[model samples]
Target: MNKTFQYVSYLWDEQKAKSLGDDQVALLIYRSNILGADLRITNYGGGNTSCKTIEKDPLTGKDVEVMWVKGSGGDIGTLTKSGLAALYVDKLRALEGIYRGIAHEDEMVGLFNHCIYDLDSKAPSIDTPLHSFLPFKHIDHLHPDAAIAIAASKDGEKITAELFEGQIAWVPWQRPGFDLGLQLRNALDANPGIRGIMLGGHGLFTWGDTAYECYINSLEVIEKASAFLATNYGKKRPIFGGEKIKSLVGSQRKEQAARIAPLLRGLASSYSRMVGTFNDSDTVLQFINSHDLSKLAPMGTSCPDHFLRTKIAPLVLDIPASQDLSDLGAVKSHIEKLFADYRDGYKKYYETHKRHNSPALRDPNPVVILWPGVGMFSYAKDKQTSRVASEFYINAINVMRGAEAVSEYVSLPLQEAFDIEYWLLEEAKLQRMPKEKALSRKVALITGSAGGIGKAIADKLAEEGACVVLTDIDEDRLANARKDFGKDAAIAVKLDVLDNDTIGQAYKAACLAFGGVDIIVNCAGLAISKPLAETTEADWDLLNDVLVKGQFKVSQAGVSILRTQGLGGDIVNIVSKNALVSGPNNVGYGTAKAAQIHMSRLLAAELGPDKIRVNVVNPDAVIEGSKIWEGKWAEGRAKAYGVTVEELPAFYAKRTLLNEIISTKDIANGVLAFVGGLLGKSTGNILNVDGGVAAAFVR
Candidate 1:
């Protein structure tokens, strides 16, 4: 498990990136991406890396253009020439003192660029002023997982002292951007050879004469801390839960793995570059795995940087009860409870420490979790995300478990977490980049997309236009849709929502095919007929899982992709009339539909400020074979309703004031209206394309 530690050698490869006219620019981006890949180092745009070069000022008769920073809204991995924004060091430093009096941060942000009056489309990183303030030519600021993991602990100061042995200075978490930059200036003045500084739970700040030195310092800091934690706690070796009983649980590890891989894929697609799954259920295997599990689970995050990628919690399993439930219901319930507990703990933590200016709480779900005898659950939003979550979990668990042997493990303080969460500087940096421009280069995933509704919506988006990844449960239909649309228009992926893992995989495929995903349409849904009491639990579960739970899982999985892309995105859920208006024989279908509607709304509200938009399309009875109208349903219900096959259209269509069947075109258009931003200031709002069905007044 030993890895080489090198600064100049690891980060200075010319072949890794495209050749640049300015070698400094090329090195800056390459180094940024390398650091970005390590969770212990960065999270979605949290850190900024820059290179300084002297260029003659046109008017000042002196050298300027001291720095080129990572552009706001660009991930380090995908950073491009357009992603590196420039700032004149002279202007930045002089302007710094000018905006000091501005109380509002946002207003102060405007001042950073005020001195240089020009139409600069790209907003400078919030740290522009700080970069201006720094004398170092190469600066790297990261929320390294190991350093912060120790820094966030109860005795962070003490533990950090022991780990680094006075190699670096430490600062309490301060609001990043201007204030922290000023504080860092003070720290730098105090400690001369301090290669790095830990900002409590926030992250780490490091600088050197070049990108090579900065990156090397980042890697060395984490490696040293990891070594300390391992030496202290690695000897514990093992931990255990309830013993598995064989009779009740026939080894379904393969089956479980098969079932979960797609779900994990879906979750992973939402965040990373790739994803992988592993499952094992042999009692012997479980025992073998227990030692590592015990060591890692109790350990806090490998480092605070891991938090941005994997979150602060992992799913733990109680072995005995897992075998009792024979069906997926039990598994779903068990997993749900773990996520719920994590969320609850997060909220309680927030309440305890949010003395004032508490920001909105992040979703409590663990990015990665362990399934005990069943192995592990790597819940990433994408492939690279999967890697990020998996690696961080392993490291965090290893470190924390090791620390427990020497001392009680403690988490980063709540206030420190808050500082990272609502650090206005990071938010401001994200705000600088344009939303449309940020998402312009990425791909998207759209489900329930054959012909009619899904097709039309997809087409509209393609025209707008985006690289669309389309999917549906219908194999033949999906094939035809692809043929007609052409491969250039969209890549058709056959997906079954019933299989959670498949849906996950579909999302991953979409992301891989197209650098990243920018939008997701949970259009895969169906209507089942049955009286309320007569609807069997099986029926209820089937429809509910497909419509409600399916959407939930997909959205949850897609979040990381959207966030990582840096540009916020849009999610459109195609709901039904049953959600808004009750109808006979719509039991299980209606219930699930209702949940989908509310879920979309809640997500819209929660993700709004992040620049993500969520909305729903509730269309009334659409025409047969016309997207929302499944022709098969008409055949089954025709006999039950005592209506001729010919009369079904009239029977359904007459319910609307327009007296016309809602076509797939109408439903799809309504969905596009929201996602395309046609309807302004209308988020979390439902648009009913029921042919004015509500105006009909069902007697």
Candidate 2:
């Protein structure tokens, strides 16, 4: 089939680009292709690119304009005014002498901090200092398809030398950021007038006096090398017609548009308020249906730059025409097998070629897949991500076609792709944060949270900046409680502890609503004041269900989500003071609380491997705004003490060393304390928030 290339211009509007301020222009570039699309093509933010904008900085005694680079975690497409972090050029260049001696990540992080405002943003992209060392006015580093096609081949050096004819210099792919940047600096120093640099199993870096020039050089360099490969390997026999493939992909595209339009709209609606506004119809369904998918898949990426969009691979499913395979377990299983085999092959390749830490095997999903009749699978993190992935695929197809025309295009090893995909330090950086302050992005679930102790713990956690999901069976009390805290203070859920399934569903809903859960405080418990003979089976069951079973179920669900994020979490259970110092009348409630204490310890021991910490907070005499302060709970106590209802609280408070009522806020603070750094390293340890009542009795 004679395929006609479609020109889909992604370049920004010239007027828009012109009107942008220096910071805005840099952001636009970072937001568009350079950062968003560029980082995705390799591994987790693998390839680095920076623009040398003239900016004023006070150094020595005079003010000078130096380059400020994109800080780490600064998603290019999502790049904002705060994303471009500053680094002094002289300081960056000076590191060239000692970059090799840095042994730990902290040293590199320190070096980056010396040149940047660490508090303002994430660690500057490891390439920040490297970009600072470069002499170019405008710079771009990418994993281009054409370059790697030649570089990853058996005769990579020979092929690149013949293709570029000594125009582009090549470097072996080293660990990126500091190490790789140092190597490149040395290479550039040795070879004075090099236009571009190609890292084996990595990508390409090019710079110029202007954006257009730099972009043009990138296009021209790849275009020439791709032309050379195509001249040699161009297909002579017309194995497939372009029209036939297009027709098949066209119909599938229509179906895909229908399936994804609503879904993309929903996702956009959910996230638009935060950042990265929604994609238009054209972008949302850009590559849903592609005509010549077979031809494109073999082409791989126009360069390695497509990884940011397509990922390392896509999840390929062979759907049978007779059955709806999307929901079929058998179909899903088959797809899983294909992904596993592909990953296994990648592992073997990695072991054979690379000598270093073994990369984590990512999900064996293909970044781009060829479906026989439906067309191609273009996968990405989101809508814009998909769009970027498709562009890389299109470019890769063009480069591969051109390279094939010149010669057989050699692909990179699967292991090399794995190295780029599962870079450990890169993965570590994505999850790195202060453990105590990590709850900022997390949602916390606290049960038995209405009035008294439960409400207190909920309030403290909310004040500490956690989005609290508070639940209790008291519908009226819970509603009034939420109102008291204000509408947006916390989410109030009516939870019946007796219903195990409902507790599980609540956990799931919290995750779906607010990303994932970081903490679970099981405080929804009740006390049954009765003699052992008077305590019925139903009363015993009720106590066990709320105090012991409910906490267990919710914590189970919370752990699963936490593990996916790769951050260990914490859980606090609200046990009663009676559990430690019990009376004959409180047998049922005390026994349930006893079981809860042991359960918390067991969970702590079991979950310690995953870094999930669990502990208990025992509260005494919490009767504010409750029947316990007026009715049956205070009835017998008042009579025995020969005191009034208000005096009962005072009597209990006086028995303690501090002589202060343990308010809901007191217990809540204890929960928050455990949530933070105040608890030291102890887990499974019981915290007494009872005004020293238990300590006095022990002494």
Q: Which candidate is the best by lDDT?
A: 1
- Residue range 265-376, candidate 2, lDDT tens digits: 2222221210011121231222323333344444344234444345544433344322353333445456546656655654564566553664454433344543443434
**Each model's lDDT:** 0.62, 0.58
Work out how many backbone clashes candidate 1 has. Answer: 37
RMSD of each: 12.6, 12.1
Expressed as tens digits, the lDDT of each residue in 313-407 for candidate 1 is 56565544234433444555555565567667767766776646544554545556566555555654333345545555554553354345445
lDDT of 2: 0.58
